[model samples]
Target chain A: MKRIMILVLAITTGLGVLAYTTHSAPQADDVKVISITAKKFDFTPGEITVKKGVPVALELTSSDRVHGFSFPDFKLTAKIEPGKVTRVVFTPDKTGEFTFSCNIFCGSGHEEMAGRLIVTD
Target chain B: MKKLVLAITVLLVIALMIGVGVFKLGLVPVNADVPPSGLETRFIPIAVHASVANHAEEQPNPMVPTDENLIAGGEVYTVMCARCHGVPGRGPSVLGASFYPPAPQFTVQPSGYSEGELFWIVKHGIRNTGMPAWGRLLSDQDIWHVVAVLRRLNSLPSAVENSRSKLH
Candidate 1:
């Protein structure tokens, strides 16, 4: 009887741990992927709306010239070269409207080469 | 024939004397502080018009007037152009007003300026004007984006409008 009770307790704890691990383990599928195209002086979809707390993957592709994407608040920067796609994955923990600008010297409009990242609850 | 020649020589001497007098007397308005004369106002337009004759009609704009394109274009314009062209419903621009002819309000379309003409002007810039040669600083695609924005400078999409305000 004692042996059976010990085995049952161990099995119960093992199953609970197993269930917890299965429930909490993060899967690659959790990341929401969004693709954006950048050009000489602009980024398409100049405004990006995303939910806070969700892991976001941004695939930035440039069509005309090289540009740099910099999210100052998050300290995230990525280089977007011409005819190339740059990938950046990040979780937006804060909520509000944050600006992301091009760090590269693109052209006359380079200073205004910016987009809005709106993270909402 | 001798009288005609003598009269022509007198007129030439008078013209030379007047030119020298004007130079010595500081009669010309050399400062930008003073407004341009009536003839200058007319001369600038004629000069700009003559430049248009040099370039051929261009192909159509390849980019559609989608929200994405307009918004992107608006962003570019806001950064590089708004300072001079002036913004809509926002009142007159101090910097633009200081210029000799002053910058045109983008909200108002100049009569008979096609997309090609506008593109050429932006790329090459007008001589003796505040406009700079954007070709040296911007890509052709970028210039086209600005041209797209100019097409809808008055009637802009909400997204673009929002971005424009934010950019300001």
Candidate 2:
């Protein structure tokens, strides 16, 4: 009975550690780099598509004022300031349609400053 | 009596097993886009409040609410909190609402937390939430200044409001 209990504890602990360590690390594939431009209230490439489970590198630049790129689906956000390139890297874990929007209150059309991210499996 | 106890134990074990299986199977929704359930909105704050109570020190804000401090706070807020918490005149931040717990819209609804509580939250941040600890990036004075700004969001001085307005 003592040995059985010890074995169960060991297995549970091992499984917990394995799950924690190996859950979100995707294999090293060529990062799909995409450049996005932000202005008053819009992303230049209004729509972006990438493969699920692959790493993506986004090079974000702003032409005027400070803009925020918020992709809530992936819990990603970056500040795009004029005269600076903000690089954001993330792996899309889910395959679906996600909306990326400017969170910063830029101007009258800030609400409409949104784009779509289609992650394909 | 023995049989009844045994049966109850077996039933409890089965229910526990089912609960663990459901969680492990990913039946629980983790999507950030969906509005938080009533249970989450109600229970999570309770946990946060208790944790804050335990960890937060009862330190009063050292910074006075002068134009200089308030304006400084506004600047920090614009660069840091505005994206998640929102700014004045922007109706219901879409990005703020998209977080799992949803970042509080300080512009629309002023924080009810006390100066000390707000200070602790801003400095340390809530765990497992969208809030990030600014202690590393911002100085202690900056945190206190922002706390003052939060306390006066509804009634910011004209100078501070004007500076914020220029951003929009």
Candidate 3:
């Protein structure tokens, strides 16, 4: 009975360690950095292209008013306030066109604020 | 005695499973989707200011709160902030209503920030929210003036109440 209990504990502990190590391992892909600026309900350079399997680091800023950067498909959103720099990082696993839009209502033309991220193989 | 020990062991395993499940699957509140109202909007700024005051070791603002300075700030607020925050007797703007966290009707109750705290937020702005920092476009004095204006917002002359009748 004692040997059986010891064996069960060893198995559980081994499994837990394996899970932790696998989860903490870094990916093999490279990272690309993209800088974007928001002003007057629009994002400057409204489109970006990145390679699939690469991580993206988005450095964002705002010149006027507060704006929200939202990618609905990715369930990601961040607010860019005037005179502040914000950073968001994500890995694009699939190749597709992802829509990005401003969620904040800055002015009359707020609805037209949009951008696109094209991920390629 | 053997049966009683087996029952206790089963109960302990069940309790451990429940604990693990609760930790893994966060129990979100049922009303998590319900949006906050105008009154609740003030809480963010108040909380932020209090936290900054408690934790941030920064210099306090140097602007003197003269009546002239306040009047200048009021003018700036009327031109810039009044649309969303609203003027006296008017409600928040149409755009303000659609925000996930609705903008506060500053006319009802002025922001609970001290003069210095208000100046810092206006100059540096809040992160991940629709509050813009005026530091780039407006000079330091300009932001300070806006702060002075926000201080006196409760006593300002009433504007025409067009917002009450306007469609959101």
Fnat, one value per model: 0.04, 0.00, 0.00
Where does candidate 2 stray beyond 4 Å? Answer: A1-121
Model 3 bad stretches (over 4 Å): A1-121, B1-34, B37-47, B55-68, B157-168
Candidate 3 lDDT tens digits, B74-152: 6556656777787655656655555556566677767776777677776667775576765434455667767666766
Per-residue lDDT value at B51 in model 2: 87
**Top-scoring candidate (lDDT):** 2
How much is the lDDT of residue B36 in candidate 2?
81
Model 1 per-residue lDDT tens digits across residues A1-121: 9999999999999999999988986777898888888986778979999999999999999998777787868868888887787999899999999988776556555767788999999
lDDT per residue, candidate 2, B66-161, as tens digits? Answer: 999898788777767787888876766888888878889988888878788888898788887888866544556768988998888778989999
Model 3 lDDT, full chain set: 0.70
Clashes of 1: 0
Candidate 1 wrongly placed segments (more than 4 Å): A1-121, B56-58, B108-111
Per-prediction DockQ, in order?
Answer: 0.03, 0.02, 0.02
lDDT of 2: 0.83
